[model samples]
Target: MKRTIFQSIREYKKQSILAPVFVVLEVLMEVLIPLQMAKIIDVGMAGDGNLPYIIKMGIILVVMAMLALIFGAVAGRLAAQAGAGFAKNLRHDIFYKIQDFSFHNIDHFSTSGLVTRMTTDITNVQMAYMMTIRLMARAPIMIILSLIMTLTINAQIALILLITIPILGGILIFIAKKAHPHFIKVFDEYDVLNNSVQENVNASRVVKAYVREDYEIEKFHGISKVVFNLFTKAEKIVAWNSPVMQFTMYAVVLLMVLIGGKSIIFQTMETGELTSVIVYALQILMSLMMVSFVFVMIMIAEASADRIKEVLNEVPEMQNQPNAQKTVKNGDIDFDHVDFSYAGEGGNLSLKDVNLHIKSGQTIGIIGGTGSAKSTLVQLVPRLYDVTKGSVKVGGVDVREYDLEALRDQVSMVLQKNVLFTGTIYDNIRWGDENASNEEVQRVCKLAQADGFVQEFPRGYQTKIVQGGNNVSGGQKQRLCIARALLKKPKILILDDSTSAVDTKTDALIRKAFREEIPNTTKIIIAQRISSIEDADQIIVMDDGKINGIGTSEELLKTNEIYREVYLSQVKGGEDDEK
Candidate 1:
């Protein structure tokens, strides 16, 4: 997983390497300053006024301090540059990978989970990367060099660090192991909290219509409380880190003072050597604290790295075969003994042994009750999901043999749920064909019976649409969506109950325009209203993932039991409304 994530640091490899080199230089300057201080105290102040020698060592100390400051500043700038660049490239790669995901791949992950991985998880990894390059180098080099300096001054005081370091190290390790699992649980809770906010914002109108704002607030509070408690549990364990380090630091300092004071009284160690030993002891203990801080960051980043690796290493479930067919010849579709299941091979099939053929330039209608797999059947023609048993062919070629982009370009599907992005009406329709002319855009809107209401606005086609087209009525949104699909000029057009929101007269006009203007394109309509499909060339009756009937309306009235019952009930209801 680390190998996969580090590959995103493409162009910033130079900066990543240079930052640590400067950190090493800064550590060297810091260690030498203590040695210079020992010289100033012993050689210059030994005889009651070697004033020239003291001034010389003091100037050297100031120069070393300034050089250390310059190196530290340069290292920090380089680390920031490398970290921000790596994050940008990583986000770019993850988004491109998501674009290639098939329907099956998308179903395996929740929307909120993927969003968190791209955003919060990546931020954690970036911080860890920056610290690993800078502080990881600075802490160890400072510890090793400081220990060497202390040993040369006095061996007895240096032994205090050797013993105290291990005891402090053990405490940090125990605290890290206990706090890590809580951090993992805290991130998982973040996904649920984000999902709750997303749902409430998207369905704000429904909540207001039902006056359920209080209920939504209570539900959100419940999820937020879980996240808060998990974070608190993790932080409480980490809180032990500071006080333990302080106690260890103070205790080691006192031990150094007591041992060095005894040596001074016995005339074994000089005053200059004792002063340098105290400075080295403080440096070594502070470096250990920095190590503990880096370790904690690594624990959190390890959890986040696993999530990011899952997205980067995911092989797309579908891809084009070698030398795949590039062009769709015509709109003829055939489903030959096809069986499909959402749960791969061993699960219950949503579409069962479906056999149907549609000719080029023919208009077909499909009718079924709820959950009868109406949308599932049309989704196969565009190769949204592959068949498990048999094959789905478009233009007499198996869908798997065709390039995915070429096949989907010819088959335009306006789904059951109409969606419009935030843009002007012209901009939204232009998504169908970006190169379409202004006249071409207006023509399709007229055919879909959308131009009348759109012209009622002062800006005509240039009126801005709010998010999700919330400013428009349901029927207006439906008509605008139909106009967008018509601009595609595809070889095959599938409308899955898309006209349910419009009135009967407008629906008939749209169908009439399809018949007169684009008669050569194959059309498929799935509808709940019988009036919508009564005039089709042939209608299909589906029940329970199987074809129950297939014939003309007149023939189905006498032959198919399911079609006869549905037709009689609708006709009688129309007569009652008239009376």
Candidate 2:
């Protein structure tokens, strides 16, 4: 875990090194000042009231104080820079890794869990890094230097302080071991809590429509209570640190006074030396306490570090082959004994042994029940996932043998669950072609039947869409998504139930527009309605994980029982509704 995180400290290596260097200098200066103070107390004030000697020592002490202050300030700035920069790079690395993920990779991780890792986990690591460079580096050096000075003054008092070290170290280690697991559980609970919030906000309309606000609040309370209980347990263990430190502190001080006082009275130890030893005692014990605090922080951040490493260590399931084809010459698709699974090998296959060939410029329709893997089949065309067995070929070349970006650019798919970011309607549509002119943008919208509704809005194409496009109707949202795909002008366009909410007339018009305006583009429509695909060149019916039948709509109705039944049911339902 340490190795994984340290690699992200690429450009910040200089700042990381400088932070500790300045911390050592600051601690050295601080240790020397106490010795000067002891001289002023025992020698200058007591013996001959040596005014000139005291003035000289005092001036030296002031200069050391200023130097320590400057060193501390510089160390603080460097630590902040290194910590924040490390986190910034880690976040960028994690997000870019996520972008490279295949469908199989995303299947194993939850959206909310990834969000928590990128945010809360990274923040924990950042805090730990800052403390490591400052307190972790400074405390040990200060303790060792102070102890050396104390031993020189008098070894007996130094021995008394030294015994306290192991006992405190043992207790702190025990506390850390007990608290570490609880900290890990705390962030896991945070993932659940964040999931709850994301679910509620995204579905607020549905919650309001069903009058389930009170239920949502109760559900939120349940998760929040779990998180609170977890943090309470972790903190209770950590809270033992303070009293342990305080007790050891007073115990060492009392022992120093009792032993050193007798030595001073017997004239074996000078008053100035005894005073300096007392100062060193405080320095040594406080250094131990600081170390304990740093240990606690590392213990907490260990869990976070592991979580971050999970993301950083993940290798994307699919990668482009060496010297892969960069251009997709055509949209022809062939499924040659293809198989797929969300799990990689020896896992249940979601799609099985499917064979279908689509010529360039042909129109195909895919109809299937939920979980029959309609979306899974279409996703393969763009290399969103690699086949578990056999091959999926585009332009007579295996998709795995093409550059990922080049493959995806040739295929445009509007997913089942689409999203519109917070931006003007024109801006969202321009996502497909950022440099698209106003004329080109309007043309796709017109073909999607979205231009009419968009113009109805006071701001037309410039109207701002709220997050998720909640301001628009479901049908309107679907049309806008289609317009975005149309702007891609891809050779192959897959609409995965994209026009479900639109009226039958509007759906027919969109299909008509596709035929007239983009005749050479291969179009695949996945729909529930039989009427949506009746005019297709070929239609496929899927059952379970296999292709049930594939033929033109007219041929399927005459020979395939599944197609015959569906067509009659829909035709009868339309007639009955006319009554």
Candidate 3:
């Protein structure tokens, strides 16, 4: 985990190292200042009537103080740069890893949970990092140097600190252990709160439609209360450090004043030396307090580190072989005795023993009930999920044997959920082919039956779409998504209910355009309405994860019971509605 996280410090390594170096210089100057004060008090002020000696000490003291301020400023600047850079690289790493994750990997992490890890968790780690480079480096060095200076002044007084240091250290360690679990639980609750906010905002229309605004408010308040309670518990554990340090610090100071006062009265220790000792005692205790604060921050960041490492360490479930095939010559797809379980080999299968083949340019239609695994079958051609047994071959090559990008590039899929980003219509459509010419974009939009309405808008294809295309009608969004897929000019195009929102007339026109203009592109249309696939070269009927029937529309209507029942229900219903 440490190795994975620290690797993100790539270009920031020098800054990370140098920040602490400056901190060391600053600590050295601070330690020397106390000693210089002692010298000025004991010799220049008390023993010497020489003005030059006092003036020299005063100048030296000013220079050291200035150097300390300069070092501290440089250290702070470097620490900020290093910390921000580390966070930037870490966010990049985690986001890239998430992009490579398969559906199975994504299933293990909630959207809100991943969002928290990338944001809140990384912010915590960044704060800890800045503190580590600045205060963390200075504290230990300051403590050790101050202790040595105190010992030089008087060992008996210093021994009192030695005993107090161990007791304070024990108290901090105990608080840290108790506080850590609460912090971890607090971050988990944070994920829940973010999830609630995200879900509510995305579904605000639905909430208001059903008049459930009050219910959503109550739910959000409950999650917020959970977060508040967890944080309060964690902070309660951490709050012990301040009082513990103050009590121990004052205890040591009181003892030093008693012992050193007696020694001064007996003429055994100078008043200047006793003054320096008190200053050193405060410095040492302040350093310990800084360490305690750093410790608490570290305890919090430890959980964030684990969450980040989980994303970095997750291996993609499927990978191409080394020196893999890079070309897909055609759209011919063959599913040979394929068996699949989303849960891996041991889990219950979602697709079982599915065998089918399609020629390079043939149009195939798939129809099935809600749980018949229709989408599962089409997803395999793009290598979205590997079959648990047997093989799904595209272009006569096993998907795993080909480079993932090269294979996916040849297959354009319009998923069941048609999505449009917040951009001009042209920009969204051009996602299918980044360098598509204006003429080509217009041609595809016409073929998808989207050109007419798009042109009706004032700015035509340049009109901006709201997020998720909510500003547009559902049928319009579907047509635009279909146009986007058509722009790909891919070897195979799979539309998984992409035309469901469009009216029957528009859907028929889009399919007619496909048959006429892109006849050579293999089309796999997954549809709920029989009319959508009725004209395909062949149709597949799936039931309970297996093929129930495969034939032309007329043949299936005559010979297949399931197909016959669905066809009569749809066809007669249409005629009855006409009457």
Candidate 4:
């Protein structure tokens, strides 16, 4: 929390200064007013007829009070503005940093963990900043200034307070140290609760389908209960400080009254001096209590700050080289003994000693059973996850040597799980090429066989898609994803089981369009359905993480057992159907 507080203060250094300055002035006003009160009682009342001097002092106190109020308000406004502005920018930076993270970094943290960091964690830090500016700043200044003022009044009475202040300060520091760890635990529980809730929400359909509503509810309740328990424990510890400080102050006040009354009766102190001394003692104690409250707030902020720093300090796995050269497309890809893994989990290689070459304008097909590493192989082309061993080259140059954006621009992938943002059909399609025209969208939509259904909607291309494109059917979503990739007109296009949802007729139409419209592009199709890639110029059959066979459909049927099995499973009267 100290780290998060410092980070926020560092972000808005100018505004933080205003808080302390205003607090100092406010404390000075408070200290001076008591001195003026003593003067009015002792000097003004003692005079025979100097009412004007008393009136003047009263006016001066009022003016000083007004100035303090004005400065306090100004400082408060500045602090609020700074805190809010700092939070807004920090949230924006965290979000953008998450977006920039490569797959390696993304997989390290859960979605819920990242969400918690961005939202709940940041909010906690923001609250701490606001509270610090509003109360924490004034607390210390009041304590110090009141102490200085009290010391000038009566050394004996001030000496008693001096003893109590250190004891109260010691209690504050001890509680702060213990409470810091609890705040950390509270935040961790927050993440757990967020993760459970997010998982349940995303899988609500599955929960309903499985009729496991009770099970899910029980799971959520368990997580919520743990969060509540942690919160209660932390709050209980924090709640002790205020009451303890109040009780301590009460004890000190009673002692001061008894001792002060005896001093006045014994003529060691005058009546007005006794009254002034008591007022100063209360002021000093009250200020110390405020300081204690500030200490508590700082402890919490310090914990929050540390959590935020962990995220900001994380080093991204992938970063562009200094003055990296942009890839100049020669339309070729070569994989030379490429090996990769998800991270940690040891070297369970996704692609091992694999070699492949794709020249300009060639269409290649990759087919394999589940866990065969097809998607992982294609993902390397765009450098989504860098290969742990061996080089993946684009246009005769290693992909690592090229600018990341330049490398990505030459390749377009329609992932197996098609994702669509909320927008009009045209806008979604235009995502492939932000500057693509209406004609280009229509051409690709027609080629992908998506035009027929898109035209059926009331607004046709202008129809608004809901979040994740849930408004459309699965097949429609796949077609739109395909259309989006097509609009890029990229040099290398990867269709990863993108046609799985579409019927054979629509798939055939899309394949035909690919041949005519994108014949010059290097295409890699990863499919489970044999028919989807059976007619490719070349097909690579994979088993485990290695390529088992590389050949045309007719050649593979006679040579590769895995390819033969896949073919036989999909096509009845198999070899004869090829004729």
Q: lDDT value for candidate 1?
A: 0.90
Which residue pairs clash in candidate 3?
Answer: none
Report, for every candidate in turn, its global Cα lDDT versus the true structure. Answer: 0.90, 0.91, 0.91, 0.81
Cα lDDT tens digits for candidate 2, 1-579: 379988999999999999999999999999998889888877788866999989999999999999999999999999999999999999998999999998778877789999999999999999899889999999889988998888887889878767877888889889888988889899989999999999999999899999999999999999999999989998999999989988988888888888889998998887787778888888888888888888888888889899888888888888988899999989899999988987777889999999999999888999878889999999989988888999999899999999998888789999999789999998999999999998899999999999999999999999999998999999999999999999998999999999999999999999999999999999999999998998999999988889999999889988888888888889888899998
Supply candidate 2's per-residue lDDT for 381. Answer: 91
Q: What's the TM-score of each model vs. the native?
A: 0.96, 0.97, 0.98, 0.93
| Per-model root-mean-square deviation over C-alphas | 1.8, 1.4, 1.4, 2.8
Task: Give the lDDT of residue 216 in candidate 2.
Answer: 98
Candidate 4 lDDT score relative to the true structure? 0.81
What lDDT score is found at residue 294 in candidate 2? 83
Candidate 3 residues lying further than 4 Å off, grouped into runs, are: 47-50
User: Which model is ahead, 1 or 3, in terms of lDDT?
Assistant: 3
Per-residue alpha-carbon lDDT of candidate 3 for residues 1-579, written as tens digits (9 for 90 to 100): 267898999999999999999999999999999888878887888854557887999899999999999999999999999999999999999999998888888888999999999999999999898899899899889888988988988999989988887788888989988989989998889889999999998898999999999999999999999888888998898999899888888888899999999999998888889988999899988888888888888889999899888889999886778999899989999999999999999999989999999998888999989999999999999988889999999989988899988988889999998899999998999998999988899999999999999999999989999887888998999999989999988899999989999999999999999999998899999999999999999999999899999999999988899999999899999899999
- Can you rank all candidates by lDDT, best first? 3, 2, 1, 4
